[model samples]
Target: MKPIPLQRRPRGKKPLWREYAEALAVALVLALVIRTFVVQAFKIPSESMLETLLVGDHLLASKFAYGIKLPFTDTYLYKGDEPARGDIIIFRYPNDPSVDYIKRIIGVPGDVIEVRDKQLYRNGQPVRESYIRHTDPTGREPLRDNYAPVTVPPGKYFVMGDNRDNSLDSRFWGFVDKSAIKAKAWRIYWSWGGLDDIRWSRIGKKLL
Candidate 1:
């Protein structure tokens, strides 16, 4: 008797749409991961950082510069370097956590900060700030020009904008808690002034 022929099963394949969907899902997850733990992008909404950062400037911020925090929480997974003086950072607004703000760290914990006649002083000595600009250098506003010395409390930081005269910063609000800080400004990736204007010089510029 002739031997019976064996039956063969065909290999299964995923639908084209399913393969595309899977690829897209992976891409989105990677983007979210990078945004949460590596870096993020921001745009300059105002002239608060003038000359230093202009309106419409798009920049990248290093989220891991401070620490790797758990998603949607203040708890850190891996603690990183602390914010130092002169470091520009993005943080949640103290008065309104729903809002985000950007400013430079002027004083760290236990630091005494003051301003006299438009001059910034830290620890009773004049702090050199070549990047700061004074739109109203002669303005006599007490808070803007002659602020009384105050110590930055522990786990808090005193921050200010590069545009000394026009910015509403720590002098107007209060200290930024360490937990509220989000990321450090890294570099400018793109800049647009208007429909027909692009700030070519600002592109690729590093944030000091």
Candidate 2:
């Protein structure tokens, strides 16, 4: 007598809800990874940065530009190059770690910086900042216009907003620790004016 062939069992399909849930979980993980180590989005909420980063502008920052910091901690897993002068960076406010601030790197570690008559001097040489804007051209405050020279401490940076006349920056708050820095501003992804006025021209513009 011939031997009977054995039948194979068909695989069962996953439930629709389960499939959707799996997809959603995957998406969330990917987003978290990107935000933590690759890049992240931020909105400009103040006019301190002005022409360089206008209020209501949505931008992307490169988290890996300087290094990869461990999530929920200031420790870095992979160290990168130090932030260079002129780099626009997002960092934790020194006074309040819960708040984030964006500013341009004016002085890196060990650089001598000063503000004389509202002009920035680095290492005793005048810095010509074409992007610098003054909302009140004639207005002058003692510390705002004439800050005494100071050396940026090791593992720290001196930062200032592009809107020199109105910004409260390193001249007021002191240096930003390297561990507080999060990312470098990469590009403007979106922007809007008062109410419904969308700034179409600023979208996709690269931040200097």
lDDT of each: 0.94, 0.92
lDDT of 2: 0.92
Residue-wise lDDT of candidate 1 within 1-208, one digit each (tens)?
9999998888789999999999999999999999989999999899899889999999999999999988878787999999999999999999999988999999999999999999999999999999999889667997888899999999999999999998999998889999999999999999998989988888999999
User: Which regions of candidate 1 fall more than 4 Å away from where they truly are?
Assistant: 1-8
Q: Which residue runs does candidate 2 get wrong by more than 4 Å?
A: 72-77
Q: How accurate locally is residue 152 in candidate 1, as Cα lDDT from 0 to 100?
A: 100
- Residue pairs clashing in model 1 are none
